[model samples]
Target: MSTKKVSIGAKPTNKPATPTADAWVENRTAADAHETMKRLTIDVPESLHRAIKSQCAMRGTKIADEVRELLLQKYGNH
Candidate 1:
């Protein structure tokens, strides 16, 4: 297979990397609201908490989102 090499100075396509403000506003619906929000407090070792926080920062997301994603993957969003 042949590979195409891009020039170092080439500009990227005209596309937004992430969702735009308009898209975010339009895509958010009533179902997205935290209607059944509940507090989940747990005690963990300081090292574990620090690791979780560091991973969350690296992924540019909140601990809550990371935990929710894990829960969704394990238990599903039923």
Candidate 2:
């Protein structure tokens, strides 16, 4: 006798896929009212990096968003 395999889990939906950067920027505007976005890179200690990632995950946040908020608070013009 032959048996068919069945999948158990939520089925995929027909919703459109959003690009990572686009989704991240959605409902968020540039601080300067400009249409350009720039990438910033910095090096951090491995332990610090892991800690930030873990905390962000637990808080349901993104590292980039958190960093941006910090930078804006420090240097952005009110």
Candidate 3:
């Protein structure tokens, strides 16, 4: 067998180092909506934080749902 020293710049690239935006997310249909959930984040002052937690427990639901309901009530158009 013969030995060969390949050139340093001879390597080939078939793709980009970073993917396009479309590659990051895929299109979804209504069928997928039932299987997926979204998350949101918010910051509250320490004084009223416990009250929010208690309200969530009273509603027998997650803190996220409680917050969403409150915002919808306050800003219905949005």
Which candidate number would show the highest TM-score if scored against the true structure? 2
Query: Candidate 1: which pairs clash?
Result: none
Candidate 3 residue 75 C-alpha distance from true site, Å: 2.6
What tens digits encode model 2's per-residue C-alpha lDDT throughout 1-78? 999999899998999886787567554567766655566889999999999999999999999888988998999945
TM values, all candidates: 0.53, 0.54, 0.40
lDDT for each of the candidates? 0.80, 0.83, 0.66
Candidate with the larger lDDT of 1 and 3: 1
How do all the candidates rank in terms of TM-score, highest first? 2, 1, 3
Per-residue alpha-carbon lDDT of candidate 3 for residues 1-78, written as tens digits (9 for 90 to 100): 999988677578777678665554443323425543344567888768888788778878887666767877998933
TM-score of 3: 0.40
Better of 1 and 3 by TM-score: 1
The TM-score that candidate 1 achieves is 0.53
The regions of model 3 sitting more than 4 angstroms off are: 1-39
Task: Give the lDDT of residue 25 in candidate 1.
Answer: 59
Top candidate (lDDT): 2
Q: Candidate 1, residues 1-78: lDDT per residue as tens digits?
A: 999998687687977689888667556643575555555678999999999999889989999788877988999878
